[model samples]
Target: MEFSGCWRNILSVAIAVVLLSLAPPLAHTARAQSQAPASSTSNENDIRAATVLFYAAFNSALHGDLAPMSAVWSHRPDVTSLSAAGGHAKGWNEVYAGFQNIARLYPGGNIEQRDMTIVAGKDMGYSVCIETGQLRSSEGPMVKFNQRATNIFRLEGGTWKLIHHHADSNLNEADVSASR
Candidate 1:
Protein backbone atom coordinates (compact mmCIF):
# COMPACT_ATOMS: atom_id res chain seq x y z
CA MET A 1 0.00 0.00 0.00
CA GLU A 2 2.88 2.40 0.76
CA PHE A 3 4.43 1.70 -2.64
CA SER A 4 1.11 2.52 -4.38
CA GLY A 5 0.86 5.80 -2.39
CA CYS A 6 4.36 6.77 -3.39
CA TRP A 7 3.53 6.19 -7.05
CA ARG A 8 0.41 8.39 -6.69
CA ASN A 9 2.49 11.27 -5.22
CA ILE A 10 5.05 10.93 -8.03
CA LEU A 11 2.24 11.06 -10.60
CA SER A 12 0.79 14.15 -8.96
CA VAL A 13 4.14 15.93 -9.04
CA ALA A 14 4.63 15.07 -12.73
CA ILE A 15 1.16 16.42 -13.58
CA ALA A 16 1.84 19.63 -11.66
CA VAL A 17 5.13 20.18 -13.52
CA VAL A 18 3.41 19.66 -16.85
CA LEU A 19 0.67 22.15 -16.03
CA LEU A 20 3.17 24.73 -14.83
CA SER A 21 5.20 24.44 -17.99
CA LEU A 22 2.11 24.86 -20.18
CA ALA A 23 0.97 28.05 -18.42
CA PRO A 24 3.53 30.42 -19.95
CA PRO A 25 2.78 29.52 -23.54
CA LEU A 26 -0.95 29.83 -22.91
CA ALA A 27 -0.46 33.26 -21.34
CA HIS A 28 1.82 34.33 -24.16
CA THR A 29 -0.72 33.26 -26.74
CA ALA A 30 -3.46 35.16 -25.01
CA ARG A 31 -1.34 38.29 -24.80
CA ALA A 32 -0.40 38.00 -28.46
CA GLN A 33 -3.99 37.65 -29.54
CA SER A 34 -4.91 40.66 -27.45
CA GLN A 35 -2.23 42.72 -29.19
CA ALA A 36 -2.97 41.36 -32.66
CA PRO A 37 -5.09 44.32 -33.73
CA ALA A 38 -2.27 46.73 -32.97
CA SER A 39 0.13 44.64 -34.98
CA SER A 40 -2.33 44.58 -37.84
CA THR A 41 -2.65 48.35 -37.78
CA SER A 42 1.08 48.74 -37.95
CA ASN A 43 1.25 46.33 -40.86
CA GLU A 44 -1.37 48.32 -42.77
CA ASN A 45 0.49 51.55 -42.15
CA ASP A 46 3.72 50.05 -43.40
CA ILE A 47 2.07 48.82 -46.57
CA ARG A 48 0.64 52.23 -47.29
CA ALA A 49 4.01 53.86 -46.76
CA ALA A 50 5.70 51.31 -49.01
CA THR A 51 3.13 51.84 -51.76
CA VAL A 52 3.73 55.55 -51.56
CA LEU A 53 7.45 55.01 -51.84
CA PHE A 54 6.94 52.86 -54.92
CA TYR A 55 4.73 55.55 -56.41
CA ALA A 56 7.35 58.13 -55.64
CA ALA A 57 9.96 56.13 -57.51
CA PHE A 58 7.62 55.51 -60.42
CA ASN A 59 6.50 59.09 -60.73
CA SER A 60 9.97 60.44 -60.33
CA ALA A 61 11.16 58.14 -63.09
CA LEU A 62 8.31 58.60 -65.53
CA HIS A 63 6.62 61.94 -64.92
CA GLY A 64 9.22 63.99 -63.09
CA ASP A 65 6.88 64.27 -60.12
CA LEU A 66 9.10 65.39 -57.30
CA ALA A 67 6.18 65.99 -55.01
CA PRO A 68 5.46 62.33 -54.43
CA MET A 69 9.12 61.56 -54.09
CA SER A 70 9.66 64.32 -51.64
CA ALA A 71 6.66 63.30 -49.63
CA VAL A 72 8.05 59.85 -48.84
CA TRP A 73 11.59 60.78 -47.89
CA SER A 74 13.20 62.64 -45.05
CA HIS A 75 14.69 66.02 -45.83
CA ARG A 76 18.01 64.89 -44.40
CA PRO A 77 20.76 64.36 -46.93
CA ASP A 78 21.83 61.05 -45.43
CA VAL A 79 19.06 59.00 -47.01
CA THR A 80 20.61 56.45 -49.34
CA SER A 81 19.77 54.47 -52.45
CA LEU A 82 21.67 51.54 -53.93
CA SER A 83 21.47 51.16 -57.70
CA ALA A 84 21.15 47.93 -59.59
CA ALA A 85 24.70 48.35 -60.87
CA GLY A 86 26.22 48.28 -57.38
CA GLY A 87 26.44 52.05 -57.20
CA HIS A 88 25.48 54.08 -54.16
CA ALA A 89 23.68 57.41 -54.05
CA LYS A 90 23.82 59.13 -50.67
CA GLY A 91 21.77 62.05 -49.38
CA TRP A 92 18.47 63.29 -50.69
CA ASN A 93 20.02 65.67 -53.17
CA GLU A 94 22.18 63.06 -54.87
CA VAL A 95 19.37 60.55 -54.93
CA TYR A 96 17.03 63.13 -56.44
CA ALA A 97 19.56 63.98 -59.10
CA GLY A 98 20.05 60.33 -60.01
CA PHE A 99 16.33 59.87 -60.44
CA GLN A 100 16.27 62.95 -62.60
CA ASN A 101 18.97 61.50 -64.78
CA ILE A 102 16.97 58.34 -65.28
CA ALA A 103 13.89 60.39 -66.07
CA ARG A 104 15.72 62.44 -68.65
CA LEU A 105 17.15 59.34 -70.24
CA TYR A 106 13.92 57.41 -70.39
CA PRO A 107 11.65 60.35 -71.23
CA GLY A 108 8.30 58.55 -71.54
CA GLY A 109 9.08 55.15 -70.02
CA ASN A 110 7.86 53.77 -66.69
CA ILE A 111 8.48 50.84 -64.36
CA GLU A 112 5.88 49.10 -62.20
CA GLN A 113 6.56 47.48 -58.85
CA ARG A 114 4.55 44.44 -57.81
CA ASP A 115 4.35 41.51 -55.40
CA MET A 116 5.27 43.70 -52.46
CA THR A 117 5.52 42.40 -48.90
CA ILE A 118 5.64 44.81 -45.98
CA VAL A 119 6.44 43.74 -42.43
CA ALA A 120 6.52 46.15 -39.54
CA GLY A 121 8.35 46.07 -36.24
CA LYS A 122 8.20 48.58 -33.40
CA ASP A 123 9.87 51.49 -35.15
CA MET A 124 11.18 50.01 -38.37
CA GLY A 125 9.86 47.95 -41.26
CA TYR A 126 10.98 46.23 -44.45
CA SER A 127 9.46 46.06 -47.89
CA VAL A 128 10.52 43.47 -50.42
CA CYS A 129 9.35 42.33 -53.83
CA ILE A 130 9.74 42.33 -57.57
CA GLU A 131 9.50 45.19 -60.00
CA THR A 132 8.85 45.11 -63.72
CA GLY A 133 9.16 47.97 -66.13
CA GLN A 134 10.04 49.17 -69.58
CA LEU A 135 12.84 51.55 -70.36
CA ARG A 136 12.60 53.50 -73.60
CA SER A 137 15.78 54.86 -75.06
CA SER A 138 16.40 57.13 -78.02
CA GLU A 139 18.80 54.55 -79.46
CA GLY A 140 16.69 51.37 -79.43
CA PRO A 141 13.41 49.58 -78.79
CA MET A 142 12.02 49.58 -75.25
CA VAL A 143 14.10 47.65 -72.74
CA LYS A 144 12.32 45.74 -70.00
CA PHE A 145 13.73 44.36 -66.79
CA ASN A 146 12.62 42.52 -63.70
CA GLN A 147 14.24 43.63 -60.48
CA ARG A 148 14.06 42.24 -56.95
CA ALA A 149 14.44 44.78 -54.21
CA THR A 150 14.35 45.38 -50.48
CA ASN A 151 13.54 48.71 -48.86
CA ILE A 152 13.97 49.68 -45.23
CA PHE A 153 11.84 52.33 -43.62
CA ARG A 154 11.96 54.35 -40.45
CA LEU A 155 9.02 55.90 -38.70
CA GLU A 156 9.53 59.54 -37.95
CA GLY A 157 6.95 61.91 -36.51
CA GLY A 158 4.10 59.47 -37.12
CA THR A 159 5.04 58.84 -40.76
CA TRP A 160 7.07 56.08 -42.31
CA LYS A 161 9.75 57.01 -44.82
CA LEU A 162 12.29 55.07 -46.81
CA ILE A 163 15.70 55.10 -45.17
CA HIS A 164 17.42 52.69 -47.54
CA HIS A 165 16.70 51.02 -50.85
CA HIS A 166 18.56 48.30 -52.74
CA ALA A 167 17.60 46.68 -56.00
CA ASP A 168 19.09 44.31 -58.58
CA SER A 169 17.96 43.24 -62.00
CA ASN A 170 17.47 39.53 -62.52
CA LEU A 171 18.68 39.45 -66.11
CA ASN A 172 21.00 41.16 -68.55
CA GLU A 173 19.64 43.07 -71.53
CA ALA A 174 19.89 39.96 -73.68
CA ASP A 175 17.44 38.10 -71.49
CA VAL A 176 15.43 41.07 -70.22
CA SER A 177 12.86 41.01 -72.99
CA ALA A 178 11.99 37.36 -72.58
CA SER A 179 8.48 36.85 -71.22
CA ARG A 180 8.39 35.36 -67.77
Candidate 2:
Protein backbone atom coordinates (compact mmCIF):
# COMPACT_ATOMS: atom_id res chain seq x y z
CA MET A 1 0.00 0.00 0.00
CA GLU A 2 2.80 2.44 0.91
CA PHE A 3 4.74 1.62 -2.28
CA SER A 4 1.66 2.20 -4.42
CA GLY A 5 1.05 5.55 -2.73
CA CYS A 6 4.66 6.60 -3.29
CA TRP A 7 4.57 5.62 -6.96
CA ARG A 8 1.37 7.54 -7.51
CA ASN A 9 2.79 10.66 -5.89
CA ILE A 10 5.94 10.46 -7.99
CA LEU A 11 3.94 10.03 -11.16
CA SER A 12 1.71 12.97 -10.28
CA VAL A 13 4.68 15.22 -9.61
CA ALA A 14 6.36 14.21 -12.86
CA ILE A 15 3.24 15.05 -14.85
CA ALA A 16 2.92 18.41 -13.15
CA VAL A 17 6.54 19.30 -13.90
CA VAL A 18 6.16 18.39 -17.53
CA LEU A 19 3.01 20.49 -17.88
CA LEU A 20 4.66 23.45 -16.21
CA SER A 21 7.67 23.31 -18.49
CA LEU A 22 5.42 23.13 -21.54
CA ALA A 23 3.23 26.06 -20.59
CA PRO A 24 5.42 28.85 -22.01
CA PRO A 25 5.93 27.20 -25.43
CA LEU A 26 2.29 26.18 -25.63
CA ALA A 27 1.31 29.79 -25.04
CA HIS A 28 3.83 31.02 -27.61
CA THR A 29 2.52 28.55 -30.16
CA ALA A 30 -1.06 29.59 -29.52
CA ARG A 31 -0.12 33.20 -30.10
CA ALA A 32 1.81 32.45 -33.28
CA GLN A 33 -0.97 30.36 -34.74
CA SER A 34 -3.58 32.99 -34.07
CA GLN A 35 -1.58 35.96 -35.39
CA ALA A 36 0.67 34.65 -38.15
CA PRO A 37 -0.45 34.75 -41.78
CA ALA A 38 -1.37 31.45 -43.39
CA SER A 39 0.50 30.19 -46.50
CA SER A 40 2.90 32.91 -47.56
CA THR A 41 5.81 32.66 -50.04
CA SER A 42 8.26 33.86 -47.39
CA ASN A 43 7.18 30.92 -45.24
CA GLU A 44 8.26 28.58 -48.02
CA ASN A 45 11.64 30.26 -48.21
CA ASP A 46 11.99 29.97 -44.46
CA ILE A 47 11.38 26.26 -44.72
CA ARG A 48 14.07 25.92 -47.38
CA ALA A 49 16.55 27.86 -45.26
CA ALA A 50 15.71 25.74 -42.23
CA THR A 51 16.30 22.57 -44.24
CA VAL A 52 19.77 23.80 -45.13
CA LEU A 53 20.47 24.58 -41.49
CA PHE A 54 19.42 21.07 -40.49
CA TYR A 55 21.76 19.43 -42.98
CA ALA A 56 24.61 21.69 -41.99
CA ALA A 57 24.10 21.23 -38.24
CA PHE A 58 23.92 17.44 -38.56
CA ASN A 59 27.01 17.41 -40.71
CA SER A 60 28.86 19.52 -38.13
CA ALA A 61 27.67 17.36 -35.26
CA LEU A 62 28.86 14.22 -37.05
CA HIS A 63 32.26 15.72 -37.78
CA GLY A 64 32.43 17.03 -34.20
CA ASP A 65 33.00 20.40 -35.80
CA LEU A 66 31.30 23.24 -33.92
CA ALA A 67 31.87 25.65 -36.81
CA PRO A 68 28.99 24.33 -38.91
CA MET A 69 26.64 24.02 -35.96
CA SER A 70 27.49 27.51 -34.74
CA ALA A 71 26.91 28.97 -38.17
CA VAL A 72 23.25 27.85 -38.23
CA TRP A 73 22.42 28.67 -34.63
CA SER A 74 21.25 32.07 -33.42
CA HIS A 75 24.16 32.29 -30.97
CA ARG A 76 21.62 33.42 -28.41
CA PRO A 77 21.21 32.23 -24.85
CA ASP A 78 17.73 30.84 -25.57
CA VAL A 79 18.97 28.27 -28.07
CA THR A 80 18.42 24.72 -26.84
CA SER A 81 18.87 21.12 -27.95
CA LEU A 82 17.51 17.71 -26.98
CA SER A 83 19.73 14.80 -27.82
CA ALA A 84 18.57 11.26 -28.55
CA ALA A 85 20.70 10.04 -25.65
CA GLY A 86 18.28 11.75 -23.28
CA GLY A 87 20.67 14.61 -22.64
CA HIS A 88 19.64 18.26 -22.62
CA ALA A 89 22.17 20.94 -23.47
CA LYS A 90 21.11 24.57 -23.43
CA GLY A 91 22.73 27.75 -24.82
CA TRP A 92 25.52 28.07 -27.39
CA ASN A 93 28.41 27.94 -24.92
CA GLU A 94 27.29 24.79 -23.19
CA VAL A 95 26.21 23.21 -26.46
CA TYR A 96 29.57 23.90 -28.01
CA ALA A 97 31.33 22.50 -24.98
CA GLY A 98 29.27 19.33 -25.11
CA PHE A 99 30.00 18.88 -28.82
CA GLN A 100 33.66 19.54 -28.22
CA ASN A 101 33.71 16.71 -25.72
CA ILE A 102 31.90 14.47 -28.16
CA ALA A 103 34.41 15.33 -30.89
CA ARG A 104 37.24 14.45 -28.59
CA LEU A 105 35.64 11.14 -27.82
CA TYR A 106 34.62 10.23 -31.35
CA PRO A 107 37.02 11.61 -33.95
CA GLY A 108 35.57 10.02 -37.04
CA GLY A 109 31.79 10.12 -36.94
CA ASN A 110 29.24 10.33 -39.76
CA ILE A 111 25.52 11.17 -39.80
CA GLU A 112 23.09 10.51 -42.66
CA GLN A 113 19.69 12.10 -42.95
CA ARG A 114 16.89 10.08 -44.60
CA ASP A 115 13.21 10.57 -45.34
CA MET A 116 13.44 14.24 -44.46
CA THR A 117 10.34 16.41 -44.66
CA ILE A 118 10.13 20.13 -43.98
CA VAL A 119 7.23 22.41 -43.04
CA ALA A 120 7.20 26.13 -42.34
CA GLY A 121 5.13 28.91 -40.87
CA LYS A 122 5.64 32.68 -41.25
CA ASP A 123 8.60 32.74 -38.88
CA MET A 124 8.80 29.16 -37.71
CA GLY A 125 9.53 25.83 -39.35
CA TYR A 126 10.29 22.19 -38.58
CA SER A 127 11.75 19.16 -40.29
CA VAL A 128 11.08 15.45 -39.90
CA CYS A 129 14.23 13.45 -40.54
CA ILE A 130 15.60 9.98 -40.04
CA GLU A 131 19.27 9.96 -39.07
CA THR A 132 21.33 6.80 -39.43
CA GLY A 133 25.09 6.74 -39.06
CA GLN A 134 28.12 5.47 -37.21
CA LEU A 135 30.31 7.10 -34.59
CA ARG A 136 33.88 5.99 -34.58
CA SER A 137 34.88 5.47 -30.99
CA SER A 138 37.86 3.82 -29.35
CA GLU A 139 35.53 1.19 -27.99
CA GLY A 140 34.68 -1.84 -30.15
CA PRO A 141 32.64 -1.52 -33.38
CA MET A 142 31.41 2.02 -32.54
CA VAL A 143 27.90 3.22 -31.78
CA LYS A 144 25.22 3.46 -34.45
CA PHE A 145 21.58 4.47 -34.10
CA ASN A 146 18.62 5.39 -36.31
CA GLN A 147 16.57 8.32 -35.10
CA ARG A 148 13.50 10.14 -36.33
CA ALA A 149 14.11 13.80 -35.60
CA THR A 150 11.98 16.98 -35.61
CA ASN A 151 13.99 20.18 -35.71
CA ILE A 152 12.37 23.54 -35.03
CA PHE A 153 13.61 26.88 -36.38
CA ARG A 154 12.65 30.49 -35.85
CA LEU A 155 13.19 33.43 -38.16
CA GLU A 156 15.54 35.69 -36.28
CA GLY A 157 15.87 38.97 -38.12
CA GLY A 158 16.14 37.93 -41.78
CA THR A 159 17.91 34.64 -41.15
CA TRP A 160 16.37 31.34 -40.10
CA LYS A 161 18.10 30.30 -36.90
CA LEU A 162 17.62 27.10 -34.96
CA ILE A 163 15.66 27.73 -31.79
CA HIS A 164 14.35 24.41 -30.54
CA HIS A 165 15.60 21.02 -31.70
CA HIS A 166 14.37 17.60 -30.68
CA ALA A 167 15.39 14.12 -31.79
CA ASP A 168 14.01 10.70 -30.88
CA SER A 169 15.70 7.45 -31.83
CA ASN A 170 13.53 4.73 -33.40
CA LEU A 171 15.25 2.00 -31.35
CA ASN A 172 13.47 -0.60 -33.49
CA GLU A 173 14.67 -4.10 -32.65
CA ALA A 174 14.49 -5.04 -36.30
CA ASP A 175 17.57 -4.59 -38.44
CA VAL A 176 17.46 -0.91 -39.32
CA SER A 177 20.95 -1.60 -40.64
CA ALA A 178 19.56 -2.35 -44.09
CA SER A 179 18.18 1.18 -44.32
CA ARG A 180 21.67 2.51 -43.82
Candidate 3:
Protein backbone atom coordinates (compact mmCIF):
# COMPACT_ATOMS: atom_id res chain seq x y z
CA MET A 1 0.00 0.00 0.00
CA GLU A 2 2.87 2.37 0.73
CA PHE A 3 4.47 1.76 -2.66
CA SER A 4 1.15 2.21 -4.47
CA GLY A 5 0.60 5.55 -2.72
CA CYS A 6 4.04 6.74 -3.75
CA TRP A 7 3.43 5.76 -7.38
CA ARG A 8 0.10 7.67 -7.44
CA ASN A 9 1.83 10.76 -6.02
CA ILE A 10 4.51 10.60 -8.71
CA LEU A 11 1.89 10.25 -11.48
CA SER A 12 -0.04 13.25 -10.16
CA VAL A 13 3.13 15.35 -10.08
CA ALA A 14 4.00 14.36 -13.68
CA ILE A 15 0.52 15.33 -14.87
CA ALA A 16 0.77 18.69 -13.17
CA VAL A 17 4.21 19.28 -14.70
CA VAL A 18 2.92 18.52 -18.21
CA LEU A 19 0.00 20.94 -17.79
CA LEU A 20 2.24 23.67 -16.47
CA SER A 21 4.59 23.28 -19.42
CA LEU A 22 1.69 23.68 -21.88
CA ALA A 23 0.10 26.71 -20.16
CA PRO A 24 2.17 29.51 -21.72
CA PRO A 25 1.61 28.51 -25.30
CA LEU A 26 -2.07 27.90 -24.72
CA ALA A 27 -2.48 31.26 -23.03
CA HIS A 28 -0.65 33.04 -25.83
CA THR A 29 -2.84 31.44 -28.47
CA ALA A 30 -5.97 32.43 -26.61
CA ARG A 31 -4.78 36.02 -26.28
CA ALA A 32 -3.93 36.19 -29.97
CA GLN A 33 -7.29 34.86 -31.00
CA SER A 34 -9.07 37.41 -28.84
CA GLN A 35 -7.11 40.30 -30.30
CA ALA A 36 -7.35 39.31 -33.99
CA PRO A 37 -10.91 40.45 -34.60
CA ALA A 38 -10.40 43.74 -32.83
CA SER A 39 -7.33 44.48 -34.88
CA SER A 40 -9.13 43.64 -38.11
CA THR A 41 -12.06 45.87 -37.17
CA SER A 42 -9.75 48.75 -36.36
CA ASN A 43 -7.92 48.40 -39.67
CA GLU A 44 -11.20 48.37 -41.57
CA ASN A 45 -12.35 51.56 -39.86
CA ASP A 46 -9.07 53.30 -40.56
CA ILE A 47 -9.22 52.37 -44.22
CA ARG A 48 -12.75 53.66 -44.54
CA ALA A 49 -11.77 57.00 -43.07
CA ALA A 50 -8.84 57.20 -45.44
CA THR A 51 -11.10 56.55 -48.35
CA VAL A 52 -13.28 59.48 -47.35
CA LEU A 53 -10.23 61.72 -47.11
CA PHE A 54 -9.17 60.57 -50.56
CA TYR A 55 -12.50 61.58 -52.07
CA ALA A 56 -12.29 64.95 -50.41
CA ALA A 57 -8.88 65.50 -51.93
CA PHE A 58 -10.14 64.32 -55.29
CA ASN A 59 -12.95 66.83 -55.12
CA SER A 60 -10.48 69.54 -54.36
CA ALA A 61 -8.44 68.51 -57.37
CA LEU A 62 -11.53 68.62 -59.52
CA HIS A 63 -11.90 72.24 -58.54
CA GLY A 64 -8.31 72.89 -59.70
CA ASP A 65 -7.00 73.16 -56.17
CA LEU A 66 -3.50 71.68 -55.73
CA ALA A 67 -2.99 72.21 -52.02
CA PRO A 68 -5.35 69.45 -50.95
CA MET A 69 -4.08 67.28 -53.76
CA SER A 70 -0.55 67.66 -52.50
CA ALA A 71 -1.61 66.85 -48.98
CA VAL A 72 -3.52 63.75 -50.04
CA TRP A 73 -0.67 62.24 -52.03
CA SER A 74 2.24 60.43 -50.41
CA HIS A 75 4.74 62.92 -51.92
CA ARG A 76 7.24 60.10 -52.34
CA PRO A 77 9.26 59.36 -55.43
CA ASP A 78 7.68 55.93 -55.63
CA VAL A 79 4.17 57.29 -56.03
CA THR A 80 2.40 56.97 -59.38
CA SER A 81 -0.81 57.93 -61.14
CA LEU A 82 -2.57 56.98 -64.37
CA SER A 83 -4.98 59.67 -65.43
CA ALA A 84 -8.42 59.09 -66.85
CA ALA A 85 -7.14 60.74 -70.01
CA GLY A 86 -5.02 57.61 -70.56
CA GLY A 87 -1.80 59.32 -69.51
CA HIS A 88 0.57 57.70 -67.01
CA ALA A 89 2.74 59.59 -64.53
CA LYS A 90 5.43 58.14 -62.29
CA GLY A 91 7.06 59.67 -59.22
CA TRP A 92 6.04 62.79 -57.38
CA ASN A 93 7.29 65.24 -59.98
CA GLU A 94 5.45 63.58 -62.81
CA VAL A 95 2.29 63.12 -60.78
CA TYR A 96 2.24 66.74 -59.67
CA ALA A 97 2.91 67.88 -63.20
CA GLY A 98 0.04 65.79 -64.44
CA PHE A 99 -2.25 67.42 -61.91
CA GLN A 100 -1.07 70.83 -63.04
CA ASN A 101 -1.90 69.93 -66.60
CA ILE A 102 -5.29 68.70 -65.48
CA ALA A 103 -5.98 71.95 -63.71
CA ARG A 104 -5.14 73.86 -66.84
CA LEU A 105 -7.10 71.69 -69.24
CA TYR A 106 -10.05 71.10 -66.96
CA PRO A 107 -11.04 74.19 -65.07
CA GLY A 108 -13.47 72.30 -62.89
CA GLY A 109 -15.36 69.01 -62.74
CA ASN A 110 -17.93 67.10 -60.75
CA ILE A 111 -17.00 63.50 -60.05
CA GLU A 112 -19.30 60.91 -58.58
CA GLN A 113 -17.96 57.57 -57.42
CA ARG A 114 -20.10 54.47 -57.08
CA ASP A 115 -19.90 50.77 -56.35
CA MET A 116 -16.70 51.20 -54.34
CA THR A 117 -15.13 48.27 -52.53
CA ILE A 118 -12.21 48.68 -50.16
CA VAL A 119 -9.86 46.02 -48.80
CA ALA A 120 -7.28 46.78 -46.17
CA GLY A 121 -4.40 45.05 -44.44
CA LYS A 122 -2.00 46.20 -41.74
CA ASP A 123 -0.28 49.00 -43.65
CA MET A 124 -1.96 49.14 -47.03
CA GLY A 125 -5.38 49.27 -48.58
CA TYR A 126 -6.97 49.62 -52.01
CA SER A 127 -10.30 50.80 -53.35
CA VAL A 128 -11.96 50.15 -56.69
CA CYS A 129 -14.92 52.07 -58.01
CA ILE A 130 -16.82 53.35 -61.01
CA GLU A 131 -16.35 57.05 -61.54
CA THR A 132 -18.64 59.28 -63.60
CA GLY A 133 -18.05 62.94 -64.02
CA GLN A 134 -18.28 65.99 -66.21
CA LEU A 135 -15.49 68.49 -66.59
CA ARG A 136 -15.61 72.02 -67.96
CA SER A 137 -12.82 72.46 -70.48
CA SER A 138 -10.98 75.74 -70.96
CA GLU A 139 -12.64 75.88 -74.37
CA GLY A 140 -16.07 76.12 -72.68
CA PRO A 141 -17.10 72.55 -73.54
CA MET A 142 -18.51 70.21 -70.96
CA VAL A 143 -16.76 66.89 -71.39
CA LYS A 144 -18.35 63.83 -69.83
CA PHE A 145 -16.21 60.97 -68.52
CA ASN A 146 -16.89 57.49 -67.25
CA GLN A 147 -14.01 55.62 -65.71
CA ARG A 148 -13.10 52.55 -63.75
CA ALA A 149 -10.65 53.61 -61.07
CA THR A 150 -8.45 52.01 -58.48
CA ASN A 151 -6.61 53.83 -55.72
CA ILE A 152 -3.92 52.39 -53.47
CA PHE A 153 -3.01 53.91 -50.13
CA ARG A 154 -0.29 53.41 -47.53
CA LEU A 155 -0.15 54.32 -43.90
CA GLU A 156 2.44 57.09 -43.43
CA GLY A 157 3.11 58.96 -40.21
CA GLY A 158 -0.23 57.80 -38.81
CA THR A 159 -2.06 59.14 -41.87
CA TRP A 160 -3.10 57.33 -45.00
CA LYS A 161 -1.81 58.82 -48.24
CA LEU A 162 -2.43 57.90 -51.83
CA ILE A 163 0.44 55.98 -53.33
CA HIS A 164 -1.05 54.95 -56.65
CA HIS A 165 -4.08 55.85 -58.72
CA HIS A 166 -5.00 54.14 -61.98
CA ALA A 167 -8.07 55.03 -63.92
CA ASP A 168 -9.34 53.80 -67.27
CA SER A 169 -11.45 56.17 -69.34
CA ASN A 170 -13.69 53.29 -70.47
CA LEU A 171 -14.03 55.01 -73.81
CA ASN A 172 -13.88 53.15 -77.08
CA GLU A 173 -12.54 54.48 -80.35
CA ALA A 174 -16.05 55.37 -81.39
CA ASP A 175 -16.64 57.25 -78.17
CA VAL A 176 -13.41 59.14 -78.58
CA SER A 177 -14.30 60.07 -82.12
CA ALA A 178 -17.75 61.15 -81.05
CA SER A 179 -16.31 63.30 -78.29
CA ARG A 180 -13.98 64.96 -80.74
Cα misplacement distance, residue 160 of candidate 1 (Å):
1.2
Give candidate 1 misplaced runs (Cα > 4 Å): 1-4, 14-29, 171-180
Q: Model 2 lDDT vs. the true structure?
A: 0.73
lDDT of 1 by residue, 1-180 (tens): 455888999989999999999999999999998998797676667766666666556656576666677677766777898867466889988877766766666766676667677788877777876667777875778887688777778778877777777888865664444434
In terms of lDDT, the poorest run of 10 residues in model 3 is 171-180
Top candidate, metric lDDT: 3
Off by over 4 Å in 3: 1-34, 171-180
Candidate 2, residues 82-113: lDDT per residue as tens digits?
Answer: 77756788988876676677667677767767
Better of 1 and 3 by lDDT: 3
Off by over 4 Å in 2: 1-42, 173-180
In angstroms, the error of model 2 at 131 is 1.0
Clashes of each: 1, 0, 0
Residues 1-180 of candidate 3 have per-residue lDDT tens digits of 455888999989999999999999999999999988786677767776776777677778778788888988899999999987768799999998998887787877877666677887778888877677788988888987777778898999998888998888775666445433
Residue pairs with backbone atoms closer than 3 Å in model 1 (clashes): 77-91
Residue pairs clashing, model 3: none
Ranking by lDDT: 3, 1, 2
